[model samples]
Target: MTVLKGARERWVRTGGTELCVAELGDPGRPVVVLVHGYPDSKEVWSEVAVRLADRFHVVLYDVRGHGRSSAPRPLRGGFTLEKLTDDFLAVVDAVSPDRPVHLVGHDWGSVQSWEFVTVERTKGRIASFTSMSGPSLDHFGHWINKRLTRPTPRRVGQLLGQGAKSWYVYLLHTPALPELAWRGPLGKRWPAILRRVEDVPGDGYPTSSLPSDAANGAWLYRDNVRTRLRRPRPDAHAHVPVQLITPLGDKFLSERLYDELEQWVPRLTRRTLSAKHWVPRTRPDRIASWITEFVTAVEVTGEPEPRATGRHAERFGGQLVLVTGAGSGIGRATAFAFAEAGARVIAVDRDPESAASTAGTARLIGAPEAWAETVDVSDEREMEKLAAKVHAEYGVLDVLVNNAGVGLSGSFFDTTSDDWRRVLDVNLWGVIHGCRLFGGRMAERGQGGHIVNTASAAAFQPSRVLPAYSTSKAAVLMLSACLRAELAGQGIGVTAICPGLVNTNITATATFVGVDAAEERRRQKRATRAYGLRNYPPEKVADAILRAVARNEAVVPVTPEARGAHALSRFAPRALRALARLQPPV
Candidate 1:
């Protein structure tokens, strides 16, 4: 656990706009960028960042006009995604230039993360990403997933909520009124205005003791959201592996909103927390542990070959377990879990530190052996090397878990060609590599091995929202089933884990349009809260995988909701389709 020691805080200028910057941990280590929700400042992540400083270089910033950052007179809708992305990238330039950064976002920040995950070029620029309570813009586009109960009351409340939460925008469209309000009428009514939109936890914040009886961060909401909503979704994003965290207790967004998040980044991993919308602040330790586990896992997948047995009939004690993107998230968790299960873990990841940490942790946990190594799951040569290395060391793989993946969450239009290709690379092609390289050997040797591929409940639930991601997961599910059919004859078991929400970091790795990472997260949080969602534990899913392997089951739905979705997908396809649409936008 990270103790609440001292953390560095600063107000810095990137462009013309200024931002509140809070940094902790060794600057040389990987940077974890933290973005807060609306009406909150960088201060919200203060205690959390200090704790995270123990393992990583944590960076938290208040969006322009929020927190301690200055609000230039007549603040431009400068909070837009492009501007915000630039601000984030600029932070990277200012702080950690040589190394890629890791991102952690909640609410509006998730939206920006959505954009971050879609571009191929940007893929090399980031190590990993996590989103909490954010929706993909293309998925969240104005399709209106609302169900208003009371006609008159609902209508009035909706209008006022929109206006109150977003008053600064209309104020910005015609800056004069906002200026007057900030200087006059609005100042007096700020209390009621702030209360209408942003929630201040009773136990948190000293603002409750202030006479003003309101928050100053509303400007962030008005300026950022109003601007993002106006622009068309961005055409592409830097394709980086992503993790999304959906809080089941969030009252702002619905679970259904994530029905097709994979369509956004195809290589997505979904994790839903049992907590409310305030994950970064409220559950920072858990969040940090999850990321640390994930990044460490990614690093461990790249280890060197251990000492080999001279000549054994079957060296099951040290078998090869090739896991893609093994440096982080489920892959990391799965890798660690497998090592603990008595298999020599071959942790594969693009990041060296993450891979190393994963292997290190697994070894520390008393795993007989663990190896961390880097390899692009999509690369034929890389995967082939993985196969050859395993073949030479252990002679045969007892288990192969294709758990490495990425998240795509933007709309079809917002995603670029690069986005599509990257999704195929890690999500589809990565699996293709694993199956072709690992499965072929298992078939040739006439020995059985369990292959478990991670897919989302979205696989069975058709989603056009995140077209690319959904399509890829669907392909994975299909491929897994098909491979199961062929390999079962050889006594090989293939299982597809269709998890609903397991409360991981996939949201941070999502890509969407228009909004920067922060704004996107806000919308996602809002939409999740508006609807009800349920999340499960990754350990439970891991247990399911182990059971599936032992039983040679075809499919494993990790959550109760997932089990229901799985049944509906087969027995009542129409009802499943209908239910999927009920979710808020991605």
Candidate 2:
């Protein structure tokens, strides 16, 4: 029995071979056909297929000589790209004879589907293509030829790096030995290898046909790899929209292999995943989401949805990010930044309406999903409840931004104990609660994540007037550093973001301690005016936060003055101290 639970199965015959095809979802809906890779059957797509069944007509078929599909008499020349394309056409024609089908492929399936979409015979049959962990053999050949012809030091290095990753390809091309290995110990240990290295779940996948599948699938590389790479077709450009999903941690393929992919795919949307090569098995939710989005866009508009017009969109798309204090100012900007990069956003604020407003706008921008939560970060019980709710509702966070903080200004002598508690409660203690609860869950999951804490330039360049505020932010800075050291081994990155002054409403709501209410208002106005004169935007700080997470930086000084203060604190402490002691005009 196949692993796909509720599938309607049938057999299609083409060119002396019979393919086992499974259909899920309503037959009248737009069709989505999933093709499996080498050494595996259509069961590879079982998880992804079930997820998309609600919205589309989902189809999965075993390639010739794998799974329940019957093999050719001579496996040597039988698994060529031409034969694979014939098999694909037969399956689609049987499923949907009138309308074109959205095509998705992984590994060797993607390699052959590249031929299906690019060749003239099957051009009208495929409406769109979503490719993962595979490149068109023709494009790859052209890449190699160009690099070898006009070689630079960087190009030479790229060639060498990819060559090293292709060590398995060399081994697969060898005769008889691969079959012997597969029939012997390798076949039995294959499932364990997938579990340990790829983190694939033991769900009775690969079926009981493991040894036969492995032995027959070896011909996939031998039959097509050498022939395609040597005399590649020049007119192999795709006729439909292409979505390329690359796994950054794939041990067998370098990211640079797609450097010149734009020339081959005119309308290309690039996505990247942090997981290993087996994303269909490990990250099925993300894979299914991307495919659904891409297929729907093409169905509606005949092109890919307007691509995310933000920095690092490829790296951040489909990831879940949570931002604290997102009602306004820096927190709101950070949430919108992640949203623009196609991340699903959770906006947390003390105010309900404001958080809801941000989430609504995030969806309008580019986020596929967005939600708002009202919580006072200073309250431990509330934070605990919020963490539990978030984990249950949204799954593990890929990124967490702790940007909630209050501003306070007064002489050290005038700032009393209550003021100290208030400042520390929201700034320092809030960060602590977020990291302890949410971060604990992230670590327990053991998949890797990032945490960002918003400190201030006043942390290092302290001011006498900002005694309580400075103490709280300084504590946050140190806490981020210590936590970064602790979480480094688990692959979680921690960053402390410091900003000198950016134009936001924090100054308006800031407290002027040791003064009358009337005087406090006057001082607040003065401070807001001064910061407004600096004319910095909170969006820039948001960009810095995303960049820090992407690069795994320890400390980031966002503004020019913040960078200067950080440099002076390191190289010239006395000068920074002197500047901190001066009285403000207000």
Candidate 3:
């Protein structure tokens, strides 16, 4: 069965091979040609092609000896990089005769595309190139030569590391052994191996032709790898704009291999993902989104440049970040921080005007896209609806900040049951709702993401006067810990950010339970004034949130007092408990 539904299929004859090509979306639109790696076919890109079909003409073609494509006779000298380039050119000419096509490749496909984009023959035919999980053999050759010529401890270590990773390459090079193994037991267990090792979803992939495909694909390495690396072209610089997406967890390639990539590609945009090698199946949404953004930018400006220029720009750029309570204070500051880092911001708040205002500011702060969402997190239905909308419209959230909350101040005895419920509903349940709805989606996407729960120093320090508030934040801190443990295997990170005495509007809005209306106003004024005197800015907490997500930290204390209290709570609990018994200034 064909993996790509509703795709138009055709054949392109190129240099003693007939390539099986599949086309999706409107042919009149800009063409995006996807080339699959070895031991796979056009079907490897089925998921990504479907996603990209909406915006561009999506094309997937089997390489000369894989899938439905006919293998060349005498496989020993058939699958050279030059032959692959010819096959690529043939497909492009057949599918898009007049327009330059946007090129995307993975694994061995990316290896050949490096040749296509660099060589003078296919320069004008290619518009832009996006490479993932693959490197140019020419570049690899030069990198290996450099380390051999001037061996240092670090360089030698890198070479040894890469050499170890290339163990599979050595196996593939053994004559007739790869073909026998692949066509027999290895083929039967290949799909299971991919599922167990790469976490690739089992969804009608590996096609039934996998055994023959793998056997025929052995010639790819034998024909090209040794010859090209030993005598790499000196002028193998890329002539087109390039976007490189590196999978940090790929076992086959080292991140250091591309350290000198900038010398070959004049215009380069780099993106890294926390994933294994098979991103086409596991991270189709992110891959499609990045491809769309790069293609659109190149189409409009005729160049590829970074959209953001802030700290951690490469990590957060083109990612989606959602911040609750984003109208003001820590929520707003955190949104701006992610915006400056080039994330697409979703500013959500209880107040529509505040959310919209934050979104507007986020756009000005360098967010490629900003949207306002109004929802009360305390209401489960509202949060559920918001999560569905975000998933359906904006794609899975890369980062979620459950920052919306309320404060209730008073002794436990003086605080009414209703008051306790109200505070718990917003402060504790709000975070639970966000985690349940959005966090579930992140896990389901399988691309990994982060969650930042806004707690307080009161969680650990404790105060007699702020009983309800302290309990709610303490629950948040513990909840984050539990989630971090549970989701670690799935690549989701959870962090509880505790801030102390930040100068924000939460102080003025805090309800004074057990006080008269006039007394409540007076208490609010006093609390706000005291916090202002302390003068800790919310932006610092925002910074901590970003850093925590990047580092995948478990629990972060934002302010000086918060850090000290956390330290004390860990080592000197008796002092904290005794301090909790004292009367508060508020």
Q: TM-scores for all candidates?
A: 0.44, 0.86, 0.94
lDDT (Cα, tens digit) per residue for candidate 3, span 527-581: 8999899999999999899888887899999889899999999999999999899
**Candidate 2 colliding pairs:** none
Quote the lDDT for 569 in model 1: 86
Runs off by more than 4 Å, candidate 3: 151-153, 514-523
Compared with the true structure, what per-residue lDDT tens digits does model 2 show for residues 1-586?
Answer: 5479889999999999999999999999999999999788899999899989999999999899998999998898999899998999999999999999999999998999999999999968999999999999999999999989999999999999999999989999998999999999999999999888887778887688878988999999999998989999999999999999998889888899999999999999999877788888877877898999999999999998877778879989888999999989999999999999999999999999999999999999989899999999999999999999999999888899999999999998898899899999999999999999989988876666899999999889988798899899899999999999999766689999999899999999999998999999999899899989998999999999999998789999989999999999999999999998899886
> How much lDDT does each candidate structure score?
0.65, 0.92, 0.92
Q: In model 1, which runs have C-alpha deviations exceeding 4 angstroms?
A: 1-319, 514-518, 521-535, 583-586
Q: lDDT (0-100) at residue 302 of candidate 1?
A: 23
Residue 2, candidate 3: how far off, in angstroms? Answer: 2.9
- On TM-score, the candidate that comes out on top is 3
**After superposition, which runs of candidate 2 have C-alpha atoms over 4 Å from their true positions?**
1-3, 184-208, 318-320, 356-372, 380-398, 409-417, 432-449, 458-471, 474-494, 512-526, 560-586
Number of clashes recorded per candidate: 100, 0, 0
Superposed by TM-score, candidate 2 places the C-alpha of residue 421 at a distance from the truth, in angstroms, of 3.3
